[model samples]
Target: MRISVKLASICLMLVLLLTITTPAFAATTNPVLSVTGTTVAPVASVTPTTATAPLMPGDTGTVVVTLTNTLKSPGTGNTTVITESHQNVYPPTAGSGITTTRQTQTSSSDGSSGACELKFVNLLSEGPIHVQNAAYTDVGYLGLGDSAQFQFTIKVDDSAADGKYYLPLKVKTDNDECYVNQVVPVVIDSTQPRLVLNDAPSKLGTSRGNIIIDVVNYRSSGINSASVIPEGAEFTFKPRAEYTVGSIGAGEMYTVTFETSSKNATYTGNPSFVLKYKNGDNWHQTAPLVVGMEPKTDAAAAGNGGGDNTLLILGGVILVVLVLIGGVYLFMRSQRSKK
Candidate 1:
């Protein structure tokens, strides 16, 4: 009877211990996260989505990025993924020019959107940090019953150089490769003319001096060379046309180096002929060349040497008219006396 009672007591103790420790063991053995109290079910996975236009030019309207974290398991905390920031803007690159890098604090929600204009870059002061880059701040994982989504939008630099710009975004979860790279093609465009004359304005003379034309790619792809028209002013050689850009890509500046023969035309008015290139469309702009001519006659030569003679001659004509008027008055007075 004593043996029986001792065996029964041992069995009872084991059962009691199992009851107490079973729950604790189960808790310890469970995975890091557990869905308790509520039912757990699987849902559809989230596939990445890309924008129609990877990026928007400063001149081209606006770009909006819609990130759908459609995963059923909502993340615990919201994450700030920076698509682009001119400066350290937590979100997108501010349209702000180089004078001031776009900052998250200065985003459209707070500051004026005009601050993001790309035209204000300080080319000489200090260049903006270019190429592609990305980062993520402290954020949380998806919670059991919650969801998080972020909308990324930014104004592309209208003047942004054309290149393969790679933008990567980091999703909060490490389980899946959440990084998605969006290859953005930046197109160069401008309402203003792209071809500009960098040649010194003072160097223009009646004799066609060497003219340097800096050509910018506003549309389509890069131009290999700009084929000029006419034989006299614009030719392939003699002046030796040189371009800053030999192999120009989209959003690039190519320079044209060529010289003109001395201005030998009869008329001395504005001598402007259209600079044309048949890349695809008829691209043309009036080349700004100043033609200086030495006058042939002594009077014309003297006029050139002195202040504007045209104004002086007008003043002299006015003086002569006044003297004639006075003489006519005196003659009339003498006739009246005689009468």
Candidate 2:
């Protein structure tokens, strides 16, 4: 009978222990849950525009770049949340108490949509070109299907060669997560129009004379609104100081004439001519070309042969008058002797 009673107690204890540990085992086996949300990054396009004419050596100009956000939808950021739990149970009896423990964890993420934040924009100088302005910082945000323009002032070195040059443009956004690097092309041309004296009189007399000059365009491009001006110390140009030559084409030449008169007959000085023309939207002037002019005497100013002939004829007339007077005096003296 005592054995039967001990067996019953043991079975009852086993049942109670199972009932208390079952919930703990179930809690320990519970699976963790995770959720995530993601959005695509924004895309941007860059385009550069230059002036109508190529940049001349040692010239200062501006370069314009247009930035467009090509993304149809706004960008979104990621967010996450985590949760955890623990459970412990102690057995109801004995020298060493049994322990049961359970742990649970969960995670979730959320995203928000909006414009793309641009951190900075920079233009890097290369070769003979130099950027005058600093990098653009804290450029604000760019929305979907939106465009922005940025202009940079640049100067070309005087020794820059004539050819195509590329400059690097860098852009950063989304806390430097997104980056863009592109090359912008530009042309450098140092050629300009040249003016030279084609045909001119060696000596300008007191009388008015024609001064002809040749306008030569050495550049690979055409120029318009062309004009020429005459400069001298003792000369006056007619009909105007500024003579309009209209247009000159690439590798072409145009001839212009000016009626010039000397202010003083004895003046001996050098005269110069200047050429002005518009290349694209910019006007340029060439260095003055100095020409020497020698003064001429009045007799030399006239026909050389005619002046010599006039002087010979006057000498002959004086000789004939003197001979006739001498003959008359001799005739009077002879008449007196006869009386």
Number of the predicted model whose lDDT against the real structure is largest: 2
Off by over 4 Å in 2: 1-52, 74-114, 175-177, 196-202, 214-227, 239-241, 244-256, 266-270, 277-284, 290-339
What's each prediction's TM-score? Answer: 0.27, 0.59
Q: How many backbone clashes are present in model 2?
A: 0
Error of 1 at 198 (Å): 27
CA-lDDT, candidates in order = 0.36, 0.67
As a whole number from 0 to 100, the lDDT of residue 223 in candidate 1 is 39
Candidate 1 per-residue lDDT, tens place, 1-339, comes to 756865654565454334121111111110122111111011112222332322223422222232333333322232222223242223333332222233222111121111111111011111111322123334444433333333232333546653434333333333323333233222333322255657633323446556556666654443333543323342222334322333445576666656544343232233232344322222333354433333244465566657677778989999999999999999999999999
Model 2 C-alpha lDDT per residue in residues 1-339, reported as the tens digit of each score: 756865655565555444221111111111111111111111112222422346677766567767766655532333333333332335554333454544444443333243567778788898998888998898987765566777777788878999888888888877444456777776788788887887778877668888888899887657778999889878888856788988888799998888887886656577788998775445678999787677555555467769889999999999999999999999999999999
Where does candidate 2 clash, by residue pair?
A: none
Error of 2 at 279 (Å): 6.0
Cα RMSD (Å) per model?
Answer: 27.5, 12.1
